[model samples]
Target: MRKRVTMCQWLSDKIDDEPEFLDNMWFSDEAHFLLSGHVNSKNNIFWGSTPPDHCLQRPLHSVKCTAWVAISTHGIIGPFWFEDDDERSLTVNTERYIQVLRKFWVALGRRRGIDRALQWFQQDGATPHTSDRSLEWLQQRFEDRLISRRCHPEWSPHSPDLNPPDFYLWGYLKDRVYEHNPQTIPDLKAAITAAIRAIPREECRRVIENFARRIQ
Candidate 1:
């Protein structure tokens, strides 16, 4: 709580110095969309006369995909999927993350007619996001526009509430996607894409605009 208060104070000071700070800010994060919708012991519940033994058997391999998404007051950037190299799932590395950023930048440029020099990019302290190679790539492209572990005005670690995508968008997306109850990987992907697209531009702007209030 102390750390959160301190971080909020720091953000408040920054916002006070620059009233337009949130306008240029972009938030990015990655989330896994599971085929089974993240069913866990605590949340999983069944009601029946008899114990459903067959339904209790867990799969040896759970099907899932990781998607990277970014949003700004202008609009959204992507639902970019992290490729699976082997049969097993893979974590995003610096190389893959950079590739995603390249695509995201192109899309962002096309949509907003803005360059990296004019924007502030915020990312969490994930290993791939903070790696030396990743930092170098971001520095070369975004320069001082970065907000990460090693960047100035660094984001508070483990503080997802400070990020709109984490605090609002992801949960909103997950709820909508699960409503479709997709049965396959492609279906899940389609659902996620559709849900993101369906989000109103005004709502997105409202969330981004509320950043100042959140910090206060």
Candidate 2:
């Protein structure tokens, strides 16, 4: 659970050695997922149109899919939903992925002028993130605010328990959004927005602060 305190320690020292994780004082990149099916009966029935012989629309198994997202404790930076497939069609690609990150930076600094550069940023070593192109872009665009980006191998994608938005945030959102079956994409999207807004700041802190304990 405790590999090293590279991220927090560095950010802490820069901002003064004070606690940061739970104080609503940090930022991180996150991904969002939209599941296609629910944990209903093993042999549930879908009441939509189907072949004369087919009884329902339910798949034989659960179809959980994900979207690439970058968010922080303050609020959502942005979200990019991937093309939905049977799930196998999805592969983690860093090249196209960096585009989403680029868009996030634009929103944080250029569009909104929130100056996310002043905030701490953390993310996993997904292929695009570590690629020469992505880093080069970061170096070019963020030349002045280079200090804003926090680098830590330990904070990369391999570790999810440390990031509560995956475990805690989505579940909270899903429970609220999937209150009923979402037959279409728009139905699902509305649910997602509602859920994201509902999660309290304190709840997010609990998950991130106790990340190490949870991992252990």
Candidate 3:
């Protein structure tokens, strides 16, 4: 609790000191979207003379897809699917996370002609994100601007409420994605991608504005 408070203050001050910090910072995180988890009772509606018996069967080991994204005031960086070398779906580990970052993040920067020095990267203290090699790779690019477990001011562990992706993006996407009631993994993935692309730039700016207020 103390650490969380301290870092919040530190970040709040940093935001005050650097006017462009929020816009340049890329806050990243991952989430698992399950097919079975899409079941919402409120969405089930039937109009008939008699009440109909409805049963929604969900698999025991539900098929799911994990997606990673980075958002900032500039806009969202990705809705990248976490897949293996063979193009099979998989959970995130140190190796896979590093691979995705190198492939997608690096490629995006190069393609857009973005200078590494102008942007800062933020990640939470998840084991895969904080491992020695991971920190080293982030340090090589972001230098002192990297925000994570061992970085300068460090990030609070139990502070998802502080991350834009956590506080806003995931919930925002899930609400619309599941609204379509995707029954298959492919359908879920399509819905997610569509929802991501639908987020307007104005909303992103407002999200960062809210973030600034919270940290302060």
| Predictions in order: lDDT | 0.80, 0.51, 0.81
Q: How many clashes does the backbone of model 2 have? A: 3
lDDT of 2 by residue, 24-125 (tens): 233344443445645442122457566577456755544444445544545564445544343232445666656666676666675343555444455555
Model 3 segments more than 4 A misplaced:
38-58, 85-87, 110-114
Indicate which candidate wins on TM-score.
Answer: 3
lDDT of 3 by residue, 1-216 (tens): 988888899988888899878878888998888887653322235689976688766777777888898877767777787875654579788887888788656655763545668888889999999998888878887789888988877898788888888888888888898887999888988999889888987899999899888887
Instruction: State in Å the error of residue 29, model 3.
Output: 0.2
In candidate 2, where is summed lDDT lowest over 10 consecutive residues? 144-153
Ranking by lDDT: 3, 1, 2
Backbone clash total, candidate 3: 0
What shift in Å separates residue 120 of candidate 2 from its native position after superposition? 2.2
What are the per-residue Cα lDDT tens digits for candidate 1 across 65-122?
7788998777787898887655344679888899888898888778745666778888
Ranking by TM-score: 3, 1, 2
Query: What is the number of residue pairs that collide in model 1?
Result: 0
RMSD of each: 4.8, 8.9, 6.1
Clashes in model 2: which pairs?
A: 94-128, 124-156, 124-157
What TM-score number comes out for model 3?
Answer: 0.86
